[model samples]
Target chain A: MSERINSAWSPSSREKERAQARKRISRKQAVVAAVSSIIVIGSLLTIVVTSPGWAVVKKTFFDINYGREVFPTVISGLWINLQLTFIGGACIGVIALGLALMRTTKSPALTPFRFLATAYVDIFRGAPLILIILLVGFGVPALRLHGISSNVIFLGTVAVVLTYSAYVAEVIRSGILSIHPSQRAAARSLGLTSGQTMRYVVLPQAIRRVVPPLLNDFVSLLKDTGLVSILGVTDAVRAAQINASRTFNYTPYVVAAILFLLITIPMTRYTDRAIRQRTNAQNAEGAI
Target chain B: MSYVLELSHIRKSFGNELVLNDLSLSVQEHTATVLIGASGSGKSTLLRCINLLESIDDGQIFLDGVEISDPLINVDEVRRKLGMVFQSFNLFPHKTVLENITLAPIKVQLKSKEEAVDAAMTLLKRFDLADKADQYPDRLSGGQQQRVAIIRSLAINPRLLLLDEITSALDPVLVNEVLSIVRDLKSDGMTMVLATHEMGFATQVADEVCFLESGNILERGTAQEVLHNPKNLKTQDFLKRVHQAGRL
Candidate 1:
C-alpha cells in the first residue's frame, strides 16, 4: 500500500519540467543581480578615485595615521555608548511592559492608567528622539529640583529610556492585540484568572511574536545612543568631534562610525534572519 | 429539590442585538440537556452565559442552589466547576495534547505535575490519543483535536460540561468520532448542557431536548418527543427543514 501511494504521488514529467524552468529563471536572475551590483560598485569606486576632489577627501576622511592616533579616545568614548544602550534598553523593557499591559487591559478601573499610557505613547512617538533628549537633559536640570542629579550621562540615559519605552510599549501592545480573542476565551473558560491567563498563556506567545520587531527597535536604540553626545557626555561622536576639530581631520568620525556599525550590523542581521525564520514557519503551517 | 444547574430569566445582548431574552432552563443531576436551534437562535450564547463567559444583563444562574450569576460572585470560582468546549476546538497551539490536558489541572486545580500527567495519560490512553499526546493540536486531525479539547475540559473534573456546537466545525466523516465521545460521556453519567445541530446524536444522548426560537424555549420535552413529535409550529418547521436536509 505504501509503495503504491508513493508511486502515484511522484511528480509527472510536465510538472518536473515546470520545476526545472523555475530554477533556471531564478538562477538567471541571480547572475543578473550579481553582475549589476559589481558593475555599479566598481564604476562608482573608479570615479571617486579619479575625481579632482579625491585627494582632499581622502586626506580629510581616510587618513590612516590620523585614525590610529584618535582611536584610543574614541574607543574609550564608545564604552559610554555601550553602557547607555545596555542599561537604557533594560529599563525600557520593564517600563514598556507595564505600559503595554496598562494600555491593553479591559478593566474600567484602569481607564485612567490606560489613558495616561496612551498619551505618553502618542506624545513621545510623535516627538523626535533628539528633541526629547535635549528637553529632558537640559530642562529637568533647569528646574533645580532638590537632590536631583544634573549629570549629563544620567540625564541622557533617562531621556533615552523614556522615549524608547513609548515606542516599545506600542510594539508590545500590538503584539498582544494580534493574539486571537478565542485564545483568551479558551484560557478563561478553563478557570484561569485573567491575571493568570495573561501571565502564563497570553504573554509568552505575545513576546515570542514580537521578538523580531523588538530586536529591530534595539538596533535603532543602539544607534540613537550616539545622540547623547549632544548633552556633552563625551560619547563616541563627541570624542570624534574634539579630535577632528583639533587635528583638522575627519578620520575619527570614520572610526566612530565603524565602531557603531560593528555592533548594529550583526544585530540587524540577526533580526532579519529571525524575521525570515518566522515567515517560513508561518508559511509551512499554512501549507499544512 | 434543587436542580444541578438552573438559569432563571436570563437575558443577554450584544450592542443593540438581543441574543438571549428571558431564557430559563434546568438540568437534573447526571443528565444531558441538548439545545436545538437554528444558526442565530442563541443556543451558543445561552451556554456561554451558563459558563459565565458572557455576563447576563439581568437574571440569576444557580448551580446546586447557589446563585452563581450574581454580580458579586467570583466568576473564576464558578468557572472552575464548569467546563466548556468551543466550536473551533480552541486548543492552545503552543501546547502538546498532553500539556493541553494537564495545563488547567495543574495551574488552576493545583494538582502536582506527576498526578496531572498520570491522569492525562489515563484519559489519553482511553481515547486512543496516547500516541498523539506529545503532538501539538495543529498536528492532529480535526476529530483528534476536538477529542483532545473534550479531554482538556474533563481534566478539570468539572461538575457540568458545556459543549457549544462541538461538531459543527468538523467534517461529516469526522463528526461521528467527536459525537461518539459525547455519547460515552453521557453513558458515564456526566452532567452536560450541549448546544448542537446533530439531531440524531441529540436524540441518542439527551435526556431532555429544548427547541429554541428567537432566544426563547419554544418547546421542551424528551428527545424523542421533541425530535419526532414536536408540538410547537416553529419547532416542527425547524425539524422539517433539518429532516429534508437529511441531518435528522
Candidate 2:
C-alpha cells in the first residue's frame, strides 16, 4: 500500500512532460521579454535622437552646463520647499485630527464647531490650492494683522496647511467611520467611558487604517508646496523660474523636476509597500 | 427573591420601527437564562438594551434593584456592572490580546497596569490563550478572537454578563470552544443572560429559557419545560424548525 501511494504521488511521465513544457514556455517568455524591451527602447531612442527637434530640445532642456549652473539655486530652493512641506505637514496633522474629532463628536455643544469644520472643508476642498496660496500669501499681509508675519514662507505654509487640513480631516473621518460599530459597543460594554473608548479603542485602529491615505496626502502636500513659488516664497519652482529666465534655458525647470521626483518617488514607494503590508496582514488573518 | 437583573415594561424602537415592545424579564443571581429566537426577533436588541448600548424608549431596568434606565442615573456607572460579548467579537484590532483584555480593567476599573495584566494573564491561561497574549486579534482564529473578547469582559469581573449571539458567528467546529467557555462560566456560577442560536448548548446551560418572538416572550420556563416540552405553538414550531435544521 505504501509503495502504491509513493508511486501514485511521484512524478509520472505526463507530469514530467508538463513540467518540461512549463520550463520551455518560461524560457520562451524570457527571450520574448528581452527582445520586446530592446525593440521598444531602441525605436524610441532612434526616434528621439534622429528627430529634427532633438538638438533644440537638448539645448533647451538638457544642457549640462546650464544644469550645473542652476543646480545650486534649485537645490537651495528645494531646502525651502522641504521646510514648508514638513512644517505645513506637521501643522496639518494636528489641525486635521482636531477637526476630524470635532466633526465626529456627538456633543451638541460642538454643533457650531462641526458646522464650521464642514464649511471649511467644503469651501477649501472645492476651491483651488493655488488661489488659496495666493490669497493667504498676499491677503494676510494686506490685513497687517498683529503678530502675524508678512513673510511669504510663513504665509505660504499657513495656506498649504489650511487647504490640506480639510482633505486630511476627511480622510481621517472616513477611516474612523470605517471601523465597525460593534467595536464601540464592545468598548462601552466594558464600562469604558466614551472618551476612554475613543482614546484607547477607536482612534488607534482608525489612525492605522488611515496611514496610507495620510501618506498620500503628505506626498501631494509636498508637491503642492511648489505652488508657494507664486507668492515669491523662493521655493524650488520659483528658483527654477528665475534661473530658466536668466539663462533662457528650461534646464533649470528640469533640474527642479528631478529634485521633486527624488523625494516623491520614495514616498510613493513607501505608501505602496505599506498598503501591501496591510493587505497581506488582513489576508493572513483570514487564511488562518 | 430579588433578581440580579430585572427589566420592567421595557420598550425600544429605532426610527419608526419598534424593535422591542413592552417586555419584562428577571434574571436571578448565579443563574443562566438563554434567550432563543429567530433572526430579527429582538433577542440581540434585548441584550443590547440591558447593556445600555441602546436606550429604551420606555421602560425601567434594575441592576441589583437599582433603577438604571432613568435618565438621571449615570449610564457608565451602570454599564460597569455588566459585561457584554458581541456576535462579531469586536476585539480592538490594534491591541494585542492581553492589551484588549486589560484595557477596560485598567481604564475603567482604575487597576494598576501590572494588576490588570496579572488578572488578564490568569484568564488567558485558563482559556488556553496565554500563548496569544502578545498577538493581535487579526492573527488569531475567529474562535480565538471570540474567546479573547469573552475574556476581556470577564476581566472586569462584572456583576452580570450579557452575551448577544456570541457563538452565532463561529463555524460549526469553532462553536464548541466558545460554548464550552460559557459552560465553564456557568459551572463557576457566573450570572449570565445570553441570546444564542445554539439551542442545544442553550438547553445544556440554561436554568431558564425564554423564547422571544417579535419583541415579546412567547414562552418562558425551566429549560426542560421550554426546550423539551414547550407549551406554546409558536415555541413548538420554532423548536421543530430548529430540530429540522439540526441546530437543537
Candidate 3:
C-alpha cells in the first residue's frame, strides 16, 4: 500500500504529456511576442529614418563626434547634479520625517506645531517647484541677510529641499496613517510608551511601506535638479545648453538626455521590482 | 483576602451607547474568574478597563489595592503589572516571535538584551514554540500566534492576566491548543480574568463564573452553579441559547 501511494504521488505518463503541451504553448507565446515587438519597433524606426527632414535632424541631433566631444563636460556637470541630489535628499529626509511626525502627533503640546506643519506642507506642495527655485535663487540674496551665502547652488538646493520635503512628508504621513490602530493598541498595552510605540512599532513599518513611493520621489528629485540650471549652476542641462547654442547642434542635448536615462532607467526598474516583491509578499500565505 | 483586582461602578460609553454601566467585580489572587456573556455585554470592555486600555467614564479600579483609576496615575506603570491578550491575537507582525516576547521586557522592564532573550527562550521552549522563535507572526498558524502572544504576556510575570475573548477568533480545531495553554496557566495558579464563549473549558478552569447581561453581572457563582443551575432568568435564557448553539 505504501509503494502504491508513492507511485501515485510521482508524476504519471499523462502528466508528462500535459507538461510538454504547456511548454509548447509558452514557446509559441514567446515567438509571437518577439515578432510583434519587432514589427512595431521596426516600423517606428523606419518612419523616423525616412522622414523628409531626417538628414538635417540626424546631422544636428545624432552627430557622434559632437556627442563624444561634449561627453566629458556633460559628465562633469552631472557630478554637480549628483552632489545636489545626495545632499538635498539627506536634508529632505530629516526635515520630512520631522514634518510627518509633527502632523501625526496627537499630543496637545504639539497642536500649534501640527497646525504649522500642515500649513507648511500646503504652501510648499501647492506652489510650483520652478517658481520656488526662482524665488529662492533670486529673492534670498536680495534680503542681504548676514551669514547667508548667496551662492546659486546653495540657493537652488535649499529650494529643492523645501518643496520636496513637503511632498515626501505627505507620502510618509500617508504610510503612517495606513497602519491599523490595533498595532498601536498592542504596543501600548505591552507597556510601551506612546513615543516608544511610534519609534519602535509604527515608524519601521511605515517607512517600509513607503519605500517605493520614496524611490519615485528620488527619481523626480534627480530630474528636478536640472531645473536649477536656470540659476546658472552649470549642471548637466545647463552645460548641454551652452554646448548646443555654441555649435547650433542639438547633439549635446541628446547626450545629456541619454546620460540622465542611463541613471534613471535602472532606478525605475529597481522601483518596479521592489513594488512587485512587496505585493507578492503581501499576498503570499505565511509571508513576513 | 484582599482581591488582586477590584472594580467598583465602572462606567464607559462610546457616544450615546453605554457599553459598561456601573459594573463592579473583584478577582481573588491565583483564581480564574471566567466572564460568560452574549456579544456586546461589556465583558471585553470590562477587561480593557482593568488593563487601563480604556479609561472609565466613572468609578474606580484598584490593582493590588492601589487606585489605578486616579487621574494622576501613570497608565504605563499600571499596564506593566497586567498582561492582556486580545481576541485577534494582536502580535506585532514585524517582529520575530522571540522579539515580540522580549520587547516589553527589554524596553519597559529595562532588562538587558541577553536577560530578556534568555527569559523569552525559556517561555518559548516550555510552550513548545522554541523552533518558531525567529519566525515572524504572519508565518505562524493562528494557534501558534496566539500561543506566542500568551507567552509574550507571561514574559513580564504580570500580576494579573486579562484575556478578552482570546479564542473567539480561532478555528474550532485550533481553539483547544490555545485554551490548553490557559489551562496550564490556571493550574500553575496564575491570577487570571478571562472572557470566553467556551463554557466547557470555563467549567474546567473557572474558580468562579460571572454571567453578564447588558453591561451588568446578572449572576455570579461557581461554574456548576452558573452553568448547570442559574438563578437569574437572563442567565438561564443566555445559557439556553448557548446550549442550542452547542457551545455550552
Query: Each candidate's chain A: what TM-score?
Result: 0.89, 0.90, 0.94
Per-residue C-alpha lDDT of model 1 across residues B121-193, encoded as one tens digit per residue: 9999888889999998888889999999999999999999999999998999999989988989999999999
Candidate 2 or 1, higher DockQ: 2
Task: Give the distance in Å from residue B38's predicted Cα in candidate 1 to where it truly belongs.
Answer: 1.4
Which pairs of residues have clashing backbones in candidate 2? none
**What docking grade applies to model 1?**
medium
TM-score list, all predictions: 0.91, 0.93, 0.94
lDDT (Cα, tens digit) per residue for candidate 1, span A157-198: 999999999999999999888778888898999999998888
Ranking by DockQ: 2, 1, 3
Which window of ten consecutive residues has the lowest lDDT sum in model 1 chain B? B47-56
State in Å the error of residue B239, model 2. Answer: 1.0
The DockQ of each candidate is 0.77, 0.84, 0.72
After superposition, the stretches of candidate 1 with alpha carbons farther than 4 Å from their true spots are A1-27, A42-52, A107-112, A141-148, A283-288
Candidate 2 lDDT tens digits, B1-248: 99999999888888988888889999999999999989989999999889888889998999999998888988888888999998889888888999999998899899999999999999999999999999988878899999999999999999999998988888999999999999999999999999988988988999999999988898999889999999999999999999999987
Task: Supply candidate 1's per-residue lDDT for A251.
Answer: 92
Which is better, 2 or 3, measured by DockQ? 2
Off by over 4 Å in 2: A1-16, A34-51, A285-288
